[model samples]
Target chain A: MEHKAYLDMELLRFTTAGSVDDGKSTLIGRLLFDTKSIFEDQMEAVKRSSEKKGIQHIDLSLLTDGLKDEREQGITIDVAYRYFATPKRKFIIADTPGHVQYIRNMVTGASTANLALILVDARNGLTEQTYRHSYIASLLQIKHVIVCINKMDLVDYSEERFDDIVRDYKDFAAKLDIHDIRFIPISALHGDNVVHRSEKMEWYDGPTLIYLLETIHIASDENHIDCRFAVQTVIRPHSEDYHDFRGYAGRILGGIFRKGDEVMILPSGFTSTIKAIQTFDGELEEAFAPLSVTIELNDDIDISRGDMIVRVNNKPEVTQDVDIMVCWLNNNPMQLGHKYILRHTTREVRAMVKEIVYKIDINTMQRQEGEKQFAARDIGRIRLRTTAPVFTDPYRVNKHTGSLILIDEVTNETVAAGMIV
Target chain B: MSHYYLNHLKELEAESIYVIREVFAQFQNPAILFSGGKDSIVLTHLARKAFFPAKIPFPLVHIDTGHNFPETMEYRDWLVDALGAKLIVGSVQDSIDKGRVREETGLNASRNVLQTTTLLDTIEQYKLDCCMGGARRDEEKARAKERFFSHRDEFGQWDPKNQRPELWHLFNGRKNMGEHFRVFPISNWTEMDVWQYILHDNIPLPQLYFAHERDVIERNGTLLAVSEFLNMRGDEIVHNKTVRFRTCGDLPITGAIESTASTLEEIIFEVAASRQTERGNRADDKRSETAMEDRKKQGYF
Candidate 1:
């Protein structure tokens, strides 16, 4: 493809999770290297480090292990984002560790991803880490899941081993809420089925990892059935020309909005017609999900930040009581009846934990009931009652409108990530 | 034709504009950190678009190391005048004269590290609550983990391990008094994306970004431009070479690359075909593997 066409390509943000031995970093490095994303200086530095460490082959993992302690210990401690591009799409890989202790990091990385790349070793088949990562991805409502059966070279490129792993994964994934799951056999170490079609895997007639990433159907990942627009801020130019213009600026969360469409503002229950959808360039005739534009109403209604605009027929639930599956992020344990700040969409309100319903054991897929307190990296279902009404949808329907974060009042640190149930 | 969705560049621009506008609404005092580089220039352009018909509501802060390229200074002045925006200059030389920071000595000495003290001082002096930067995550390894709304403590130290979880378009810029946030509007953009956006928007940049003939000395495999800030070695010889800078920084630390791309199209093509990262020419990042991380923890933009 030409450079101009490449510039017009779409973007796909994905997250990769695997155990330390599953060659996750090697897979990412191979993708970058084969796609010509690895620059000459970076390659040279990796080579020098490999020589200094007395390694025979260049350690591709060093490219991703960026921190000093991580490089010294040869482990990725936190989430690291890597960017690369192909002629078809631009890719952002949120590399997260697969260890159980870093579940919060995994959740943090997977929260914004459209797809999840879960790596499973061919020799080991599926381990507890695989189940944990897959469960987390499902819980995060990642629409697409690509299971890369890696280290095929270690298994002598055997078709039976590959089939067994796929079968095992399918059996385990049946318990997951994920719908779209695809399997690709790859040997990240030997550059097989990563960027290029593998000649060794004759039995596997699937697309390469790069091909799948580039051509996946992601346009429909967003919810187009419900119309939701959360007002981020009111844009009053206060200038001579646009003095009376009160534009509600925000990104469309769901469905499509056009000029002259009748919309309703949430929490206030006021109805108005969209006079215009404006941008810096000009007025847009219509806008859809993920497009940040300003909407001017025909009537001068009471609208401000933290308000939501939606279709009258398809309005989200507005209530002070919210049931959510919360992922604790900070070291401070979440106490019942503890008041915290709840930031949902563009709205901020004080919320207190009314109850801790249960905590899920990600590895075993079992719920531990009657859990009183929650610590960092713990995932549990809880009931929260906010001081004001918050409009939200279930995470299964729309990831953008369904998620919120809990911040500590004193520290102002994001303590927990919640997915509305 | 009426399109329902935005292209990649348009989407990136829209996201950046949203973030910039959010900074205006969320923080009491915010400023754009302008270094006259392409990224900052693009950021300033986005800030203009974010509030059209109305002037940019904040000032442009430039931490001058007193070793900047002359073209950068000229461009910075022109941009501030064109936008009708306020300009705040933080000088490392002044910091040195005030005994707030000491200048480095020897051959590899640079004012790059001293700019941190000056920057923090400027923030404190101006009482700027949030400083918007043009730092892209794709620039360096340490930057790859940066949050869009990065929080700094009372002393302006960054705690990478304890960063808040940034989710979707909702950014938490809430912080205590004396603590500030370093918000990166273009955190998701890469080097190629920046150049592509510049070309797409017809954004004017400093002349140093394009190919030009300059007297440079090759040291440590990088071509360092000869200037007053650089101390020449006994054996090092200056030679006129056709080179262009991939990044703009202090005159001594920022290296130039051999290139013949004179136009934006040619520059974009060259960037696409180039084998080295954009920061490969930066001497500050080459000091150690974690140089950017360490400097960033100490409040380096």
Candidate 2:
């Protein structure tokens, strides 16, 4: 490929959640190996380790399980990110363990993923692991999901078996709040249909796994309908050239922002027209989600960090009490009535736990009501009272403005992640 | 059909800028850990773009090992002056002089490990709550698992086993009084992406990154620049070879690679065709399987 092609290539960030039994590591290994991403030295190191351990075949997990203990135990304990590229796109894999206890790790990996990859053993179709992974993907509002029926060689590469699993998965996923679900049958260990089209499964007509990864429609993954720009900081260049330049610098979280568009400043409720969208490259006609730019307003307004710039007609709710689906991320249980530091959009406020509505059985999707205690990795619905009114949209409407993380006041650890309901 | 979607480079640039802005808003005191390397140069450039029309809001902190190449020092000084930013140098030699850290003794001994002490001391002295670094996740295995906002204890130690979970763009920068964060704005960037961006933007880099004739010695199949900091063995031989450094660090431990490529374009070509990682030449990471993990646990950058 030409060097210029690298510039045009799209970047796809995806997360994979599955147990070692599901051949998850092998699938990842296949992706890297087929793409020739694993360098000779890295492969050599893995070979040496496998030889030292007297393994029959090279263990692909060693490439990803970077930590010493994780390699020694032959299992993944935390989230590990792996990178690879094809001619079409650059990929970042947020690989997480699928153990029931490591739900926190899986959630961390899922938070920023544009797509989720859930592996299933072909022999066992649509198990609890599949449901858990699918549910988390939906809860995190991941738009796309790819379910790979791995270890097809063990099931004799039977088209009937693959179709049956796909049918079962579709039936279960119909209840999920996700779209763009796809399925592919492959043997990760045998290198069938992962990067290469499986000749054995010629009965299947879908694209290969790598093809889907490269061509999937992710241009619309971010929220482009709600105009939300969280002002991170105000840039006042007290320099000779930019003496009069006072620009609000931030990353646009939602819809497109055009020059001369009427926008409102939150908390202050002041209105201003965008004078110019400034960047290091110069002025832009418009700005959209994920671009960090500076905005010069036609009128002066009281704006600072934690303040937001949104389209006047399309505004997020400004309120103090919030109902949320809380994921317990810390080792200690959630403390009721204790003040926690709530970090939203660009604002940080003190939060008091109001009440626990119900606990979610992640695997079964059952709601256990009136449960107040939440241990590590527990997901539940809760109400919180922020010391100050927070500007937020429901997570279903906009992931950027709705998501929050709670930090323990004393220990200073990020204890919980809350999705505004 | 333009979809308002950024390409890979623009996306990466936006991500880095977002992270930089977060550090500024979240922390009272933050600084960029500068090593005068190309990565740090890219970082400094990104900081400029991040706060554009204005100067960088944070100081550029350099843990000077006193073993830097002359070209790197010149570049460092010139860049600092150009940016009009504060440059704070924490000297490893000073730490050695003050007995805060002891120097090692051997033919392969380097001040690479000693610089960690000076770095932590600098953070403590400056009361820096956050130290933005240019370290990429693709550089090393230990770093591959590192969070964008990596948490360090009051002792300046990193616990690989237990770390805060970073989700979405919502980075938890909360920490206790003495604790600080090491933020990597370019954590997702690869070596190829860095070189490609430099080429596309015509960014200036040190001549060291390009091919040049330098005095070097071969040891264990890698070339080490001949400098006073290198503890030469009795039987060692020095030769003039055309080489360039893939990574710049303490002149003693950072190995130079034999290359005919001189310009940014040529370097990118070499990088795309090269098989080894960027750190394959660094002797520090080759020490053990988990050498980086061990160093990171003890607060090494």
Error of 1 at B115 (Å): 0.2
Model 1 reproduces a share of the real contacts of 0.57
In order of appearance, the predictions have TM-scores of 0.98, 0.98
Candidate 2 lDDT over A1-421, as tens digits, reads 4688887889999999876778999899999999989888888889999999999899998998989899889989889999888989999999999988888899999998999998989998888888998999999999999999988999899999998998988888888998789999999998999999999988889999999999998998788889999999999988889888899999999999999999999989999999999998889999998899999999978799999999999999999999999899888898667689999999989999999899999878989987768899899899999999899999988899999999998888889989999
Q: What is candidate 2's DockQ? A: 0.78
Q: How big is the positional error of residue B158 in model 1, measured in Å on the Cα after superposition?
A: 1.0
Error of 1 at B238 (Å): 2.2
- The fraction of reference interface contacts (C-alpha pairs within 8 A across chains A and B) present in each candidate is 0.57, 0.72
Encode model 1's per-residue lDDT on B180-247: one tens digit a residue.
99999998899999999898878999999999999999999999999988998999999999999999
DockQ-based CAPRI category assigned to the predicted complex of candidate 1: medium
Which pairs clash inside model 2? none
Model 1, CA-based lDDT: 0.90
TM-score of chain A of 1: 0.98
